[model samples]
Target: MSDAQSLWHLADGRALTLAGAAEARRLAVSRGRVWLTLSGTTDRPAEDCWLEAGEAVALAPGQTAVLEGWPAAEFELLVPPCSAAPGRGGLLGRRLFGG
Candidate 1:
């Protein structure tokens, strides 16, 4: 998960959950569509969304997300090159999801 970007494929009806995120990241759809659910924080309400191909969402620190493919999908999870740090969570620490 340390790479700048990682590609993942989700089968129809399959789901992926990203939790305990330590840094900000982006999830972009490369092919097909996805359904996304983001956990709420003290400052904001929880959200549910649908993303089509070429769409993207920003995930905040200390949040979590649940994603499901709509008839199969390909996507990428990306992190900024400057965001990684020593002793910090490597993509699975404090997490913020959605936006």
Candidate 2:
């Protein structure tokens, strides 16, 4: 398998929102430095830690991570449930239905 399938890129000053138990995994970088802020929960970001370009960090579930600064910076992000994994379909298939 090619690693290209596992790569994701985010533009500067852009934020991504995740719902439910979803998790975001990827490699990211920011020009000078980037800040990640977690809102809607009791979790807070580490003090004075900026995400530099060419760094990898795994965003914890149930939190929103915001990327700031750096234009043209790129990163790789891998969402949960493994897109190429067998037997696992879309979110609808994983939901419960009443009889």
Q: Write down the lDDT of every candidate, Cα atoms only.
A: 0.84, 0.48
lDDT of 1 by residue, 8-82 (tens): 999999999988488888999999999999888777789999999999998888779899999999999888755
Q: lDDT of candidate 1?
A: 0.84
State the lDDT of candidate 2 residue by residue for 1-99, as single tens digits: 222224335566765443434444443553344555544445654333457766656656665555554543455555544433444444543452211
**TM-score per candidate, chains pooled:** 0.79, 0.46
**Prediction 2 global C-alpha lDDT:** 0.48
Name the runs in model 1 displaced over 4 angstroms. 1-3, 86-99
Superposed model 2: Cα runs more than 4 Å off: 1-21, 30-33, 39-48, 80-99
* Candidate 2 local Cα displacement, residue 93, angstroms: 18
